[model samples]
Target: MPLWTIYHPANTYSDKDKQDFAKDITDFYTGFGLPAFYVVVLFTEMAEPAFFVGGRPASDTVRIVVEHLARHLDDPDMRRRSTERLNSIMVPYTRDRGLHWEFHTYESPRDLWMIAGLFPPGPGTEAEKAWARANKPLPY
Candidate 1:
């Protein structure tokens, strides 16, 4: 499972923009064969008074925190590739928009992950593939 939390200045993205960005994020992980339901995105908007950078108020900085449970990049090469993919997906919403943005990821053991009272299927397994196709949680 991958959970992404995005924080930005208020009005940085419209509801539709958030929807599209969430879709792109979901697609990014599902492309690696994870179940669609396993990808969760949360968007939080902060007012200028509430957001700061380097001790100064900021309205153009976006911060993201990602949690990975289902899978992790265990090597430098894999991590690089994953970062590149994320950059590609984010350019349209971040860099291209002239916003300062940063993101970091934390990986947890898969054994700690569950959905709908059931453990998620292992990566690339038939059960996982089924969940990917269904785009929802289903008992294996």
Candidate 2:
């Protein structure tokens, strides 16, 4: 599972923008063989006064925290490529929009994750593909 938590000042994004951004993120994960349902994107809007940067309120800042439980990129090269791809994906949403943003990813053991009372199938497995196609957890 790739759980993405995005934080920005209120009114930074419209409903349509949020939906589109989430779809792009989900697509990125699905391309990697992860189940579509396993990619979760959450947008949190905060009041300007409640957000800060450099010891002062920053209304143009965005922060993303991501948790990866489905798999870990243990290879240095793979991690670099993944980061580059993700940054490119965010270019339009953040850099082009002039929003100062930063994101960090955390990896947890795959064994620690469960969906709908079932353990997710291994990467690239037929069972995993079924879950991806269904967009939900299913007995495998």
Best by TM-score: 2
Give the clashing pairs for model 2. 1-70
lDDT of 2 by residue, 18-112 (tens): 99999999999999888888989999999989999889999999999889999889999999998888878777889899999999889999898
Which parts of model 1 are misplaced by more than 4 Å?
Answer: none
lDDT of every predicted structure (CA atoms): 0.89, 0.91
Over 1-140, each residue of candidate 1 has an lDDT whose tens digit, in order, gives 88989999999999999999999999888788887888899999999999999999999999988899999888999998888887777778898899999888899998988798888888899988998889887787
- Give the 10-residue window scoring lowest on summed lDDT in candidate 2: 83-92
What is candidate 1's TM-score against the reference? 0.94
Off by over 4 Å in 2: none
